[model samples]
Target: MSTVGLWVIGAGGHAKVVLEACRAAALPVAGVFDDDPAAAGRDLLGFSVAGAVPPPVRWRAERKRGILAVGSNRAREALATRLAGVDWATVVHPSAVVAPDVVLGPGVFVAPRVVINPGAVIGAHVILNTGAIVEHDCRIGDFTHVAPGSVLTGNVTLGRRVLFGAGAVAIPGVSVADDTVCGAGAVLTADVSSAGIVVGVPARAPR
Candidate 1:
């Protein structure tokens, strides 16, 4: 397959990180696209904001492959799902350590110093942020965000759209359901269901 040149869909801080990752991988980038009028013509890491992403027709016309660089899980999912025909780029920073047996779906973004161990299954559009450690056999669902410095112990499972916050730690074999958001610095000792936000040590859902 031909190496797809990246055309980033968002021009925010997250986009900058993706651009850097692409550079680290020695992948070429076409440019950036954002809906914000003010962001148009702006430069992200020396790459110009080409223009607003046109309709599917225009995207097809250009034949430009890209990736959703949006940080928000919902926004990334919406954009990626909407432009399903667009070829999405899976970006991984050079500093990240992904085991050979790990499975990463399309549109996944793995940031600097991230460590994904053997047998981990990372779904589409998942963000494994900087310094995060995903242990053996961890399962992260689509559009989930594993925030910076977080650690998921062996066999941990995270459902779709879940957000594991910065510095949070989940114990081995625990499962967090879809859309659950764990707060920064939280230490999860048990499973967290889809209901409510979780914070603090031994992370619990506050009533």
Candidate 2:
């Protein structure tokens, strides 16, 4: 296979993790682009910072391939939209358990320790953080963020840009609508329709 030059669009911890995932998958990273120009030329886990996103055409023209390294669901959605015309690469860590029948869309980031069970469909630009469990037959929408240690029980369906907080738990068969936010450690037991912040056991909408 021909080596592809991959460009990363962020320079935070998530970017570092994504870089490693790209390396594990044998994709050569051209460099990272961050908002802070001062960050340019700085080393991140052995990868140099290139510049910022909506990067200079010269950079994009050179690399040709890119990945959105953002972790925020909203930001990811926006950035994905901004770079819609660019070729973005999906990076899945070698340690992640993604079932053969699972479908992953472009620019999705499946971090180490992620478990994507059989029949699951993860949409474009989704972020499956470390140790996140996406149980069988679940459908995760575009630009969604399943934070570290969160668990989505079987058949759960999450809409676009849905944010599941760190360690949150979504019980089986629940469906969360687009733009919803589940707070950290919350336990979702029912379907969530309105786009709002939800927290606590049996997850309730925040006041």
TM-score of each: 0.95, 0.92
How does candidate 1 score on lDDT? 0.90
Candidate 1: which pairs clash?
Answer: none
**Candidate 1 residue-wise lDDT at 178:** 91
Q: Compose the digit string of candidate 2's lDDT tens values, residues 80-142.
A: 766667777888898999999999999899999999999899999999999999999999999
lDDT of each: 0.90, 0.88
Off by over 4 Å in 1: 1-4
- Expressed as tens digits, the lDDT of each residue in 1-207 for candidate 1 is 454477788999999989999998998998789988999999899998987876666667777677789999999898887887877778899999999999998899999999999999999999999999999999999999999999999999999999999999999999999999999999999888665699999798876
Q: Which pairs clash in the backbone of model 2?
A: 33-51
lDDT of candidate 2 at residue 50, scale 0 to 100:
66
Candidate 1 deviation (Cα RMSD): 1.6
Error of 1 at 157 (Å): 0.6
